[model samples]
Target: MSSSTKPRRGLSALAALAGIIAAGVVLGIAELAGAFFRASATPVIALGSTFIDFTPPWMKDFAIETFGTNDKLALLVGMGITIALLAAVLGIVAFRRWVLGVAGVLLMGAIILASVLTRAGSSLPDALPTIVGTAAGLLALRVLIARLRRTAVGDPAGASTATTAMTAATGGRGATGVTVTEKDDAATGQDGNEREGATAASLPSAGTSRRGFFAAVGVTAVVAAVAAGGGRLLAGARNNIAAVRDSLAFPAPASPAPALPAGVHPPVPGLTPFVTPNDDFYRIDTALSVPQLTADDWVLRVHGMVEEEFELSFRDLLDADLIERHVTLTCVSNPVGGYLAGNAKWLGYPLREVLARARPLDGADMVLSTSSDGFSASTPLPVLQDERDAMLAVAMNGEPLPVEHGFPVRMVVPGLYGYVSATKWVVDLEVTRFADRTAYWTDRGWAEKGPIKTMARVEVPQSFASLEAGTVMIGGTAWSQHRGITKVEVSVDNGDWEEVTLAAEASVDTWRQWSHELSLESGLHTVRSRATDAVDGLQTEERADTVPDGASGWQSVQFTVK
Candidate 1:
């Protein structure tokens, strides 16, 4: 390649690199600044949360189905790639026209600033990190791009001088002093290749500029990494609520859940346990980062459309008469045969009692429960006031609520899908009509009242499994939530359904395990299972997507007998 072309290509690449490096500096500095404020004040977290708030329901369902618990991680990775690509473009543009690059960076900052300031409970101070970070990024970009330009200008001139010195030293002769002619140049394929020789000679001549540019890049990268790592460490130290949670001593419940039956957990391998462990519970929420809140500072305000407004502190909740119940929570986005449902023993005060103290107005039909992170759920007021064990849950199993699940406090209502009922890190309860306000998911085209559908799944003899040819045991768990699963029936390859033995029921609100032993011949076979609820409601056989409400359809798995 010609010396001019080589320098141009290198400069372009360096410019792109400068842009990427500048973006890293921006994020690192922003994160460092955010350490002084709330975690949501960080530009990436704020932007990611905003994106989640505006995402369509279908898209949200797709993400949960595609990535399960790692949806947030996937989103962050996707955002990082997108930002890097855009930054690279901005860098190239800045190299050619500096003003446009500045405009692009400023525009991104504006977007981030808006995301930070518009967050729930956000103040003007929350935008400081974004503002400061953007300024630092701009400065970094300016300095790096300036260095790249200098290199571009210096490389060609240095190459020309080096070529001239080399020609004069060689006296137009080969390295061994052999005479060179146009015919020899043509024969050796060196004809019209003076620029190539100049390009080769430019390597040492341009070493200073290359070294300077690379040194700046290296330093910037190191600083960015240090800033980012230090910021994360600082944030973790500041928001280490885990220590506080672990130190908490929860009072005994006024009413406790009944002792589990002997056969509640059937001796079936691969079947979901009757009580999902705290760590094994399914988590499907919009929180990018778990909100860190201490029990001492937590306060819940109950107001709006009420005869009396009341504020409940964490201490007050702990002192109140709490009840424990084994409740199964389901995500509306859980696909058929999906594992987005879990049962756990929850302990907390009754929501009905809490709302009773406030005396919600007669016309109020919804209770808009909002999280500390600004996510809100519009639940039916009647559901919270009903005879069900719906409560302001504070502890799961025997321990304080896990931070990710919702430390300090969260709502737990049986039967209803989590989107409409469970509001983790709950801070505000506004009683109002559903017509007056829409929740985060409801605004995104999901059903405002998300009641979980009765569904059954086949766990053992998994899909496409090869099994021994004798009597094979088929087992799984089925749930109808508030309406207990009374029977589970299994059918083989479109054959007549046979009743499966149901394990002892834990409660009307928890799922039941079921297993059936059937003799099967060799070859492929599809097993389908369906459940009947206590109210004689049968699990639907028609397939429907998990939109508007929970999914429906009997789950079927195919296996082969060896």
Candidate 2:
């Protein structure tokens, strides 16, 4: 009710609000950091998906209804809830008298505990980060509450500030006032009253406290709002950072398709001069959505069971003494003749460079690569350490990694399937044991160790009933991972094999992008291609589904040529 106290309370509230905002920023940074680390351990390609597997045909259609694959919409789907939870904790803590601050802290702790309880599961790796972050948030509340209490007790008005004017007016106040000397009290009271009135004059003049409660409330509200906004923005920034770094790693291809000399043609009719482009690279992940993240926000943390805990910034990675290598990558999910494999120039610091710096103990057999959206792949450390071009590659063809690919950084292990080797949009590389680790796909019933199955595809038409009498062109692609594709043959239905021309081989780690051209007449045709490796391993005819290991048998295409 006193005029003097209103302005002081207003100013104090503003100060408290500022503190709350700072705290919220810290909370956002923490979540972002966790997301960054979490990503390195897994591929966070999808979030809030109700059905990961066991889907019927209609189920995919229905699930798509809920979690549309348009990444931008998916990224912010649960942001409202995230902001609300963060706000409730911050708002309550920031706008408080001492007791209120304590209550706010307790509230924050309760929220954290509830989140942990709801997230219990080895399957849910994020549960750990969420719990740790929530606990830190609550602890921050406790510190803030204690500070508020101290400030309250230290104030000249003490417990009575809430109703100090009533106490002072009715002459019913106690030692909280300290009753200096009656004469001094009279003079001080007058002085306090005068200052209170002046403060009130500048304030809204509707407040009733000599302390800073009203100002604190206002400031805290503003800070809480600001913090909530920040959390949403930083939540997935690590992936975005990967996108930027990826953009740098693989750039747009230059040098259009080379003009073939007269009568000289590409063995595969559709083959381009250069192999894979970053945008067109095949992507397979559990993340229903590609998280939107940025480069400035990306950070890498290497901790736990390590002699030294290392955290890296984007610049730190770029500035590190670098090594560049070209390696071809393959996917286990690729069918016997699928397009899921490609080879390109890769540039980055070598895995040996980063690992030697970390100095892993003897028992570490796997390096778990995690993504921003919570997807993970367990990779063999020995493979990376051994005679392979394994790299923490930042660049793909010649530019940054593409967002569709692992933008910032991903693992490129030759001769292994992506499930066991390639990890994209990777944020963390935890050195651990296979017995102790399970990746996103592993939990989903995928193979524990995915090896590339040797196979080849027919690129040219061999036997056809639908081809025109005139000559038509036919061609396709083949791969054998690190072993390399050495020889290929195209055969018509029950026809003799014809040798196909191959491209200049780069390395065993790179795919030998090859093709065979054939002239065909209009007819329905059955075409088949078989590849032989450098070790003389022949392409098998045994058919297999993509399960415990890669697929088998030669690739065939049946079509009409006119």
Which candidate wins on TM-score?
1
Candidate 2 weakest lDDT stretch, 10 residues: 39-48
Tens-digit lDDT string for candidate 1 (249-299): 988889988899899977778888889999999998888878989998899
What is the C-alpha local distance difference test score of each model? Answer: 0.87, 0.56
Q: Could you tell me the TM-score of candidate 2?
A: 0.56
Candidate 2 ranges beyond 4 A from true positions:
1-47, 53-268, 303-309, 459-467, 470-472, 517-522
What is the Å distance of residue 489 in model 2 from its true position? 1.3
- Please provide TM-scores, in order, for all candidate models, with all chains considered together: 0.91, 0.56
The lDDT, on a scale of 0 to 1, for candidate 2 is 0.56
lDDT of 2 at 415: 82
| Worst window of 10 by summed lDDT in candidate 1 | 157-166
List where candidate 1 sits over 4 angstroms from the true fold: 1-6, 157-204
Candidate 2 C-alpha lDDT tens digits along 340-395: 66656676666776777787887778888787655678877777777666777666
